[model samples]
Target: MAARRADLRSALPGLRRTLRYLRPHLRPERWLLAGGFGCLLAEVAFRLIEPWPLKYVIDAVIEPGAADRSGIVALLLLCAVALVAAAGLRALSAYLMTVCFALAGTRAMTAVRADVFAHVQRLSLRFHGSTKTGDLLTRLVGDVGRLQEVAVTAALPLLGNVVALLGMTAVMVVLDWRLALIVVAAFPVFVLASSRSSRKITSAARLQRRREGELAGTAGETLGAITVVQAYSLERILQRVFGADNQRALRDGVKASRLAAGLERKTDLLVGVATAAVLLVGGTRVLDGALTPGELVVFVSYLKGAFKPMRDLAKYTGRLAKAAASGERIVDLLETVPDITDAPHARPAPRFRGELRFEQVDLDYGTGERALRDVSLRIPAGCRVGLVGPSGSGKSTLAALVLRLYDPTGGAVTIDGHDLRDLTLASVRGQVAVVLQESVLFATSVRENIRYGRPDATDAEVEAAARVAHADEFVRRLEYGYDTVLGERGTGLSGGQRQRVAVARAVLRDARIVVLDEAATGLDRESSAAVRDAIRALTRGRTTLVISHVPEEVADCDVVVRLEAGRVVEYRPRALPRRGETVDARRR
Candidate 1:
């Protein structure tokens, strides 16, 4: 009982939060909702009237009445017509209610899904790194979908049933107070059963949702890395892991279903008991001089009508619990404060001259380990600097700092003497472009891919940028030239070709600062030469930071900064090495 009370307390907050997602969307659809509710009232009225026809037939037409025998056939026909009219009106009202509620629910959930998706995108890399993509997807898609079900299906129907229940109860009381009391007496038992079973059903549903998320995450991770799985021959291992989670979800679902079934059966038993009691008592009253046969029939009909809502309420309890769980998860996600956000006074950065500086910077990745410590470096505008370091020597961390993907735990990074933290993130990022080791391209036309760098760029400008990056030659040779569509991650293109497209994109952006991180690391001899030429063109007049493990790759830099243990061990200008020179360097 205590646990059940605790669950109830928690559910109030969850329901309130979910209603926040619903309330704003209701404004636009207020009239529609009102109309739907009006239809519900009409449907309830029809139901109340529907039982009246039988009552009239029993009392006026079928009773021993010698005076009304002349119009008996007409009276019977009128009752049948009233029955059919009530049925037709009920069907029409039901259709209107369903359509209106569905529209409202769909639009509201869609808005929430969009907001969640956009918020997830804006969340920092740190959060994404710690979170699973599959779980996020499930929350964005499946969980939000459940909220819609709650609104359109469970919530709306439960509301209509409550109204109907109340109407029927009032009518029953008016017809015969004694019979109404007998029916109402069973309600407390129903409520008690529902309250107890609801907590169990809710607990089971929460477990089921959690297990489903885990199962989705496992499947997504396994399938996304299928190549690695195949190479490692871990298919059987992955299958077992997925199967175990699936089994757990199945168990939770079955438990919830079992609880719901038990509650329903209990409700049925109570309703049957109530019905039998009403029959025995009302039958005696009918034989007495107090109650008419028509009045007793009306009381029975109202009794059943009232109990119908109770049955529906019992059935919808499990769905409401599931939606509440999903709502809580969504609320938790939305409430997560981002680690990085712009200050109130942060301003848009003016056009950058790209004098990048790191002053006594430190980066702790929250694991009690520093990725960079007191790393300070300066690169003059238009100067090409090469950052030479082994893996985990804080080279990429420095670039990320400049990009504001992360803020330093200590000290600051500045561009054009303005601290990056004082600038709007969009303004800061707009002036910087990066070409990672593995060039990322969307599944789109070559022209569209290049235009992604500058959405408003003209076709001619795109072609010109492609030419500058030396991508024009190959792009034109494709089956459809610049309009040719590429597969996922630019699968149709070679490593060097993809890199050139990335360069083309950067060239179109025309950002003053460029960071090339191991951009030529995995290319063959011929591909390396082409990529190197493209990099030269890209860095012609831009302040460039080239990160490479190979000493030869950085031989032409105006200055080379070698980092060891997150500290700059060496910084000096170096002349370009000869083509055949074998320059050796130690890893960090």
Candidate 2:
């Protein structure tokens, strides 16, 4: 018993947190909830009145000669009216309760889902790289959805049932104290039974929820990488994995179901025994002239009404357990603090000249291997520099530092003499733009994809940027022109076309600092030429840092920094002519 109490105490915080999600939404719907509760009270009052009319009818029948035949007829009519009125009020109250709670629950869950999504987006790349997308999706969508069910479907009805049970119990006691005592005695037994089974039900439910998460993860991972799966003929292996997870979920679900069914049956048996005992004791009193038959009939009706909530509560035990598990998972997620957040005193950065400097910067990926060690470099305002290196040579890491994707472990990166850490993350990131090798595009219209970089860009501006990137011709030839919707990740477009769109986006951003991380590395010859033309347009007046393995791609840059094994091995400065000089003269 002590252990059970301790467990319940531990569970309360999770329940409280889950309920907190509803508080903000409930304020606006307070009146609706109050009205629903008022209706519930009226329904209970009607139910109590209902049994009295039946009692009058029974009394009228028992003593026909005590009153006129018309009196009996009137009593019977009253009974029928009371029954109909109670039924109508109950239906009305139930409808109000369902609608009010459903609305509030839906709004609360929607807000929570949006917050979780925003939080996920704000989390660092390290968190995302380590966490599975499938697991996060399950938490964001599935777990949140289950919480809604608990708040709306199970919780509302449970509340109403509890009120009804208490009301019915009071009415039963008033009708006949002796019979009420017999009914009340069974309450503790029910409580004990429920308590004993609760821990087991909760454990099973938690296991089932975990299995469900695994199943969702397996499905998402498999489908997300379907192309790779098929190319490698991993269909059978993935199928086997999915099947195993599905079977475990199924087994756990069945176990939870069985426990719930057993709990409900036990409740039924206990209620049945109590009802029989009440009938036996009350019938004897009625026969002995100590109680009227009409009173005994009322007692039986009240008894059933009072125990209905107990039975319903028993049935809902499994659902509540599952909801509790989901709630715990949600709380765990919401409680996680983001690894990277702006300091309290951080200020927005002003427009920069884009002089970037890394002073004794060090980066350790927490894997015992240092990615960058005491590396320092400087790029003057509006200067174009090429970062050349073999694979795993910290070239991309340097670019990431410029974007503030990950802060250096041991040193500071400054932009125009302002430390990156002291500047607001948003302000710093807004001034820098990147065009990666694999450009990511949403499943949207071409015009919208271009406008994503600058949401308020006009149609003319978008078109001009696309033309500069040489993507306007193909876009115009599409079925819907700029409004043509692409598939996920721009699936319908070739790699070159995608790269051009990305370039158009970067052109639209018009940031001061631009990083090209192997942007033209994977393009075919014709595509490469088009993209190179676009790059030339993009870097016309920007501070550009080009990371590449190809020497020719960096040949025109004024300076080149080459790194090997996390150390700068070479720094070469070319005597190139100033901007606007002829290409031949600059080369000379």
Candidate 3:
């Protein structure tokens, strides 16, 4: 997992990658996005127009009797009506904007989530072997949620606020030049303060989001492994550790909140100072007859409206920073290149005859330790081969190579005389089926679990597979029979039952080649025999590699290969002698 973490970290990039993901979404909804833009423009127009009525009511209606009072009354009423209409329209526009933005954002997020999942699926087994399921889940669920927040709250609002600020400022300047100048002077200072505070907030937000992911991952891992925690009597220690992590996350969140709040307060203070300065200078101008009192009032009203968006910008910057951090996390996952990939010109394998050959294959992890050194072997069409080796010898690695789980570091692996690398990964893997030592079942019905290896199999086919694996009798005894629900990872079943279901799965695969990695290692003798019977039935016409230590079972196979320290040490039944049989033992 440490190696996986290093690999993921090394691929991290700057914020530009974050913005690129949003572009495709923006492109598709150009019209709705445009409608959103139009709504924002209309909303800004309403904000700027609101003060016109104040100026009219003050200068014309309030003075009264200097003109036709009835006309003035009607005009004032009309302006009041207009103000109400504007507020209503602004709200409606906001709604329309939200609907459009959410639709676009959701579709875009769906695409991103799909791409991330697909990319993870294509990654090499080596990467998954070292990576934690909890951490990967955190990236999928938590990080994507963050990106959604960025889309809905930050990006959309930023666009609306920017336009509103500009529109309101234009209205303020038109009312009174002297007052506008006084108010505008504070603009640079507010921007500078916001920029400085935002930089700090952005930095803190990035760290805070990372910490949150780690906390989520830790919780997930602990809960998933609750059985281990209880078995080892380490529940108290695990809880304490989780508590410490949660405390650290809380502390970081608080720090982020304080910094964000400070930015809001400081922005408000600057806006207030600007308003005061405008009041002082404009009041003097009105007294000297340089501006009318109504005009001064209208200008101040516009100044207030303009500052609203500025204040909103400051407040929302913190949220935007946090969202951007999340965006970065999601984009990083989406951008991860799979360690294994299909060759561009690769084609699917057709009519598999079950002949497998390892031609001087050299396999190893990135670490200097070798798992296979120049080892070559062959399993003839429709033959059963048993691989026996001590732990850390290359039995499992050899099986993995047959299915191309990890490509050899040197040399080649071929199926039916075609290089494994030259065939599509799906094509190669589809020809081979593996039943692992530990039974992995989903939380689903017994029937569903049996059909997992071949989803398209009919109920009759599934039942036949189950019968062959000796699981049908037990399944039939259950209250719901095949429909009985299995709890998490098939926890509802006994260990032997689970193993049988796994055997049923292999039987259902109907692949040309079958590999069982430590198939009967932990089974009781009776259970092992039942499973072995199923294996024998399934491998009747398929090339098979069974990795086992039980010498009695080893004797049943036509070929028995022994490995020691990552090298083939011996081969049985040499008298049968395929032309190159000696090569298997010579590899070292």
Candidate 4:
């Protein structure tokens, strides 16, 4: 009993947190909620009124001395018609109640899902780097969807049943407080049975939800790498791992079901005992003339109506618990604080002159390894600079700071004499264009993918960017030309083709500062040349930062900065290449 109490105490906080997340969303749904609850109350009233018609019909049949033959027939007809009317009205009220709640519930939950998605998108790269894509997706889609489904299917009806139970019980007490006491006497046992089983079911359901998320994560990871899996012939290995998690989820689901079933049977037993007791006592009273037969019949009907909710609670407990678990998961995600956000007084950045500087900056990712230490350098506006270093030498880290992907632990990074932190993140990132080694492309049309760089770009602008990236020819050759939709991650295109598309996206961005991080590393000689031509066009008058180890890729730079162990070891200047000179000249 103490353990049950403790569990309940622990769960209350999580339940309250879930409600907090729901509150704001519920505001927009207030009118719909009001109508739904009003209908629910009307339905309960109709239920209470429903049993009385049967009571009147029985009384009319048993009491002939009170009326003439024609009068009795007229009363009977009225009673019969009243019963039908009450039943029909009650059903209509229920239908309206269900529709209203379903609409409100679905809309509120959808808004919540959208909010979570937008929050996750705005979170820092560090958060995304540490989180699993599949788990986040489950929270966004699966968990939120579960909340909506259960709200409509299980929660609303259960709420109506509860209200009806209360109304019927009150009516029973007024009719015969004695029989109502008998029914009420069985309540404590029902409470005990349900409370214990409900907690257990909730625990099991929470575990089940987590395991399901893990199952999704595992499947997503494997499917994303199925080509590699087949190449390495490790299909059996991954299958075994996935099967183990699947079995665990299955076990959890079964456990919750078993607990709910136990509660239901307990409810059934209690209902039987209460009903038997009521019939015994009420029958004796009827014989003693303390109550009329019709009244006893009404008491019994109300008793059944009241116990029905207990049975329903037993039946729907597991589903409610799962919804609760899903709600808590969503709240947990919503409560997560993003590491980066706009400063309270931050303003939008102006169009930059593209001068960038790192002033004694330091970065620590909490791994006890300083990613950058006292790193300081300056790049003049519109100058082409190169960064050459061993892997993990903080070359990429420095580039990331320019875009405010991470803030320095100490010191500051500035763009055009303004600290990056002083500017709105959107404005800061908007003015910088980046093309990485393994650039990511979406499963979208060629024109749309390029337009992603600038969402409002026109068709002519997209085509122009494509031509500059040397991607226009191949894109035109696709089945639908520029309108062709590629596969996931742009899988239908080869590496070089994908890279070129990414370059086109960067080209369409038209930012004053460009970062090329090994953008041409893995391409074939011909493809590399084409991409280089595109890069040259894209960075001609912009401030360009090139990170590469290739001699020719950085040979035409005005400066080359080298780093070792998170510190700048060398900063050297090279004569600027003449107009129309190829970078290949330096390699030769």
Candidate 5:
């Protein structure tokens, strides 16, 4: 009991911090909150009046010679009507309160979910590579949604009940201080029981939430790689692993339930004990001519009403604890500062002239392995460079720097004399286009997929880009032509077709610089020839970086650079072509 005040003192700061974090979302709903609170107060008032009708009904029957026959009948009718009216108003207030708060909570949570999603997308790739997709999805979808559910149903209703309890207690005190003190004295005992269990319940709930995230992550990971699992015949093994984690999560959930149930039963017993004492003391006082029967009835009714908050506390404590756990997880994710953000004084980059230079750059991926060692290179505007090396020789990592997908751990990458970090990310990425080996396509029409390169492109522009990539012929042969909807990850298309579509996207971008990271690595001979022709069209007059192992592709470049163990081993610059001489002519 002595520790109760200290516990509350410690909890108050955490409560204030939570409210501070929520201020942005809650500020817009001030009016709705006002309406809800007003209804809540009205509900409490009606509840206080609810017991008076019964008191008057009892007193009228007990009191001798209180009024004449007609007078008594009118009084009885008035009490009955008042009783029904109070109940109706109270019901109306409760309904309005629930609606108003529910609307507020829903709108706030919806906004929170959107903000979390946008922030997560903006976070750097390093953050994503380390975190599980299913864990993020859980926090963004399930955890935030749980907070909304609890706020509207459990938390808001509990607030109303607490108010009602306070109002009822005030009336009880006015009726008879002795009985009021008796009911109030039970509070310390109630607090003692709940304070110890609250921490245990919250801890249990937090552990359970973590377990659930792991369970979801395992399931999502296994399902995502079903082909690999099947190829390896690992279904039963993986299922057993998932089942064990699932069982662990179940045990955690049950532990929380048991703790909450134990607290609630203790509260129920306390309520019963307090009520018995109230009845005994009040009845004795009445027998001694110290209290009237109507007043005694009022005290008994108030006793029941006053104990309600305690009963509700027992009912909602565990649920609220879990909700609190979910809330903390969301806050942690929202608080994660992105590893990369524009500097305070950074401005939108101007149109790049495509002159790129890497100045003794070094990159260490936080692991022991250094991705790139003190590498220095220069490529003039409109130059095509071929990068070749063994696997993990930092080919893609170097291209990533030009896009500022990552910053160098040691030195800087610059375009046209400006460090990439000095410019905004959107501006840098906007002027650079990329065609990866396995480009992803959404379940949308062929036209929409091409338009993803430039969202505002017209149909004519999209078709022109497709023609340049040699994709127009095959795309036209499809049943829906440009309107044909592809399956997830472009399942309906052949590998060469998908590659051509990606090239079409890059063509539509019309950026000053392009990176083809083995874009034609997996194509057959005929497909490779068509794609090379398309690449020639795309890279003409643009600064291009091609990461490939094909000798013929490397032969077409103006410069060939090779890396050995993340260090440049060979740098050879070939002479420029003669006037009006195409790359194919030079090759022949």
Candidate 6:
């Protein structure tokens, strides 16, 4: 018991944070909530008067010898008035409460979604590089949806019921203490059952939710890369993995559902038993002449009303468990501090002279494997530096450092005289543009994809960028020219065309520094030459870094650097061998 209490106490902070997200709606809807409360109070007042009508009708009209027609009529009229008042007040409270909670739920949903998006954006590239895209999507969509369900179905209703339960219980005790004792005694059993079931179901639900996220991520990854699966013929293997995940989720869900159902059944049974006890004991009081028959009816009605909240609480248990799972996941993400963040006093880097220098930089991914070891190099402004190496030779790693994708494990990479780490990350990144081997384009128009580089760019600016990238002629041939919609990841476009669109995007950015990693990998000879020409046009007067495996592009660069075994092997200006001299002789 103590351990469970401690666990709940620990979760209190997260609950408070989740509730805080609802603050905006709470402040604005105070008047609506106040109106709702007013309606509730009126309903309670009318119920209190409900018993009086019965008492008067029985004692004055039917029970006593003075059973006058006019008196009976008056009592009937009073009873009708009480019923009408209660019905109106009940309807008003229900409507207002629903509206208020709905607004609050929507506000929480918006805040949580925004927090997840902003947090994902700020997280380190390494974090994103390693995390499954589907898992993040599940957090943003599925888990957030669970939270919304909790806010609407459980959180708000639970609050209202708790208040109503306390008020109703107090009134029952004041009206008749002995009958109230019967309810009070049974209440503890209901609370105990609720708490125990909630803890078990909530724990299982949290695990289920995590597994579901993994399942979603797996599905998303496979669907996105269905071509790879087909090429590799791994569909059966992936299906088995997905099946196992689904089976585990199913087992957990079944366990939670059975447990919640048992609690609900037990609560209902208790309500039945409590009603029986109230009737038996209250019947004795009425026969003993201590209570009137009409009073017994009212007391039974109040007992039923009190149990109504407890019955509804049983229904909310499952919803609360689901919400608790979502709450924990959201809290875990929101509380995680990013590995990379802006320095307290970071400033924008001064206009880069484009002097790139790596001073004995060493990097490790903490998995006992070094990606770069004691690497050193310098490239002056307006120079084309080519990085060439076999696979796993740190060629890509070097390019990532230039983009500040990951801070070096040791040493410093400087732009001009400023340490890249000391400059604000956004400022450094804003000035550097990267075009990778596979450029990702959205399911949108060509103009929109190019405009992604500079959202505020005018149409003229976008057209100019496309022209510089050598993509204007083809773009003009499209059905809507630049306005033609492209498929997801630029699916409808040809390989070279897609690459050119990517180049156009980078060209539009017009950053002072550019990094091209196998940027022309998929293009044919003609398209490759066109892309290379476009790249030359883009990189003029900018510090450019190219990671290449081909001799043609490497030969065009002003300086070539080679990497082997995570260390730079050579750095020199490229020149044709002397006439009648063998190139192999120079390598020795």
Please list the C-alpha lDDT of all candidates, in the order they appear: 0.85, 0.83, 0.78, 0.85, 0.85, 0.78
What is the C-alpha lDDT profile of model 2 across 1-588, one tens digit per residue?
222233233345667777775577567778777876787677676667677777878888996476677877887897889878877877776777688768767877888889889988888888887877888898999999998987677767777766777887787777678888888888878777777676777888888988888888889889989999999999999999999999999999998899888889988999999999998999898888877888888888888888877777678778878888898887777777876678788899999888888888898877888888888777777778898999999999989998888888898899989989999999988888789999999999999999987889999999999998899999999999999999999988999999999999999988999999999998899999999999999988788999999999899887888888888888887755355332111110
Q: For residues 168-236, could you state the per-residue lDDT of candidate 3 as single tens digits? A: 667667767667777677766776666666667777778888777778877888888888989999888
lDDT of 6 at 414: 92
Model 2 clash tally, residue pairs:
0
Worst 10 residues of 3 by lDDT: 1-10
> By summed lDDT, which 10 consecutive residues of candidate 1 come out lowest?
579-588
| Runs off by more than 4 Å, candidate 3 | 1-15, 64-69, 574-585
Judged by whole-model lDDT over C-alpha atoms, candidate 1 comes out at: 0.85
- The TM-score obtained by model 4 is 0.94
The pairs that clash in candidate 2 are none
Better of 5 and 6 by lDDT: 5
lDDT of 5 at 467: 100
Error at 472, model 4, angstroms:
1.9
Instruction: Tell me the deviation in Å of residue 425 in model 3.
Output: 0.9
lDDT of 4 at 229: 100
In the range 1-588, model 4's lDDT, one tens digit per residue, is: 221233244245556777788989989999999999999999999888887877877777787477577887898888889989989989999999999999998889889999999999888888888777878888899999988998888868877877887788788888889888898777767766677678898899899999988889889889989999999999999999999999999999999999889888888988998999999999999889888888999999888988877777778778878888888999988888887788998899999988887888999976799999898887778888899989999889889999898999998899989998899999999999999998888888878888999999999999999999999999999999999998888978888888889989999999999999999998899888888988998998898999998878889998888888889888777964345322211110
- lDDT per residue as tens, model 1, 359-414: 88889988899988887776678878899888888888888998999999998899
Residue pairs clashing in model 1 are none
Best by lDDT: 4
Task: Name the candidate, 3 or 4, with the larger TM-score value.
Answer: 4
Candidate 2 vs 5: which has more lDDT: 5
Q: Which pairs clash inside model 6?
A: none
List candidate 2 stretches off by more than 4 Å: 1-11, 64-67, 576-588
